[model samples]
Target: MRLLLVEDDHMIGEAVQELLRAESHAVDWVPDGNQADAALLAQRYDLVLLDLGLPGRDGLQVLRALRARHDRTPVLITTARDAVAQRVQGLDAGADDYLLKPYDLDELLARIRALARRAGGHSDEAYACGEVWLNPVTRQATLRGQPVQLSGREWAVLLPLLARPGAVLSRAQLEDKLYGWGEEISSNAVEVYIHGLRKKLGADVITTVRGLGYMLACQPAP
Candidate 1:
């Protein structure tokens, strides 16, 4: 999943970014609230990890602005403020979940997974298409019940395709899913990943739309 982390503390932000990247998530880390607001407005993210004590606007102000614009992107507040009133204010301002600073990293990741699942309307962690199955949390894939090895970039390309089988996604759309802010893209990165996926999952698993892009050959099982 792609995530935007709005945190001013370099230590906390870098730690969180590293953890999420280890879990195969593309993350864009920004310090200060104004940059956060601008990033929020500029790009799409699966989740936002916001810190309240921010430079040039504060997290609550950013949250309110997002809500005012009716942006329902799930937000998980990661702030040092622990007071009940502050928590209430944050939630009322439109935070989906709140985590106090000095919290458990495991819990933080769990919360992130929960918010992502909720946003995607997923009842289960596993995504399946025909004989291929992918567990995002585990960053694992299987074909016909056997384990299928996939690289980080390969998983990035495959996840969105698996999520919406049969729906054509343009190269630009897939690139958006594959790369995050400030990340450079190669000319044929999408095609390269698609070719790799086809080699592993089978040549017929992905259907090319020529000028349009690509789509999955399998639909979710009923």
Candidate 2:
């Protein structure tokens, strides 16, 4: 998934960004609320990791602005403010979840998975379409009851297509999910990954929508 991380502390930002990238997520990091707001305005993200104490506008103001604009992208507030009122304020201001500073990395990952599941409108930890199955946490995929090996980039490319089966995601959209800022993108990177996925998962697993792009093939009735 493509994620926007709003954080000012260099150490914390670096650590979290590294962790998320290791998990195959495309992440964009900004150090202040103004940059965060600008990033939000400029691109689409699957989720936003927001820090409450921000430099230009402060996190609450940023959250309020996002809601005022009616942007529904899920936001997870990560702040040092442990007060009850502050937590309530963050939630009421539009945060989907709150994590106090010094949070466990595992817990953070779990929360992210939960939020993603909710956003996708399903509660299953593993996403399945027809005979193919993928578990985000385990980073495991299987087809026809047999395990399939996939590279990191291949996993990243297949994830969104699996998450929303019928949605047609354009090449540009898939590229955004596969890479972050400053990362080099090959001209035919999406096509390469798609070919790899089709070869491994079966050509019929993903259908080309002519000029529209790609979508998971609808399963035939049993």
Candidate 3:
């Protein structure tokens, strides 16, 4: 998933970026609020990890502007201020979730996954469509409870499609999801990844809509 991290603290931003990247998430880190706004304007992120104590624009103002524009990309506030009122204010200001400073990477990741699931109205972290089941946090893949290993790129493509099932994701969309924007996309990259996914997860898991794109066909078993 693509993430936009808006944080002024250099150390914190670096740590978060490293962690998210290690988890196969593409992240764009910005120090101040203006840069954050610019980044948001440029790209559509799966999530935004925002810090309230930013240098120039301050986090609240950014959140306000985001809400004003009716942008619903999930925002998780990571700030040092831990007062109850401050938390309430941040929530009221449009934060989908809050994370106090001095938190663990695991917790933050859990919240991010939870937010993604909620934003997409998932019933559980273990997302399943037909016989395929995927656990994003654990990187676990299963077919009817039996483990199935998937390549990194395969997981990346499948996760995004699972995040919003039935949505036809074009090749360009999958390219961006597999490799971040501006990265070189080889002509056969998407097809190769899709072929690998089908080989491992079962051919019927992902359906190609002629020229429309790939969709995770959701249906009940007999």
TM-score of each: 0.93, 0.94, 0.90
Q: Candidate 2 lDDT, tens digit per residue, 121-219?
A: 877788888888888878889998899999888898888988888899999999998888888889999999999999999999999999989999955
Query: How many angstroms is residue 51 displaced in model 1 relative to the true structure, after the best TM-score fit?
Result: 0.6
Candidate 2 residue pairs in clash (backbone atoms < 3 Å): none
Candidate closer to the true structure by TM-score (higher is better), 1 or 2:
2
RMSD of each: 1.5, 1.6, 2.1
Ten-residue region with minimum lDDT total, candidate 2: 213-222
lDDT of 3 by residue, 14-99 (tens): 89988887777777889999998888888898899999988889898899899899999999999999999999999999999999
Each prediction's number of clashing residue pairs: 0, 0, 0
Task: Please provide, for model 1 over 1-222, each residue's C-alpha lDDT reduced to its tens digit, 9 standing for 90 to 100.
Answer: 789999999998889988888776788999999999999999888899999999999999999999999999999999889999999999999999999989899899989988887888888998898899998777679999999999988987888888888899999988877667778889999999999999999999999998999999987865
Give the worst 10-residue stretch by lDDT in candidate 1: 176-185
Report how far off residue 43 is in candidate 3 (Å).
1.9
Ranking by lDDT: 2, 1, 3
Error of 3 at 206 (Å): 2.2
**Which candidate comes out best when scored by lDDT?**
2
Error of 2 at 213 (Å): 1.5
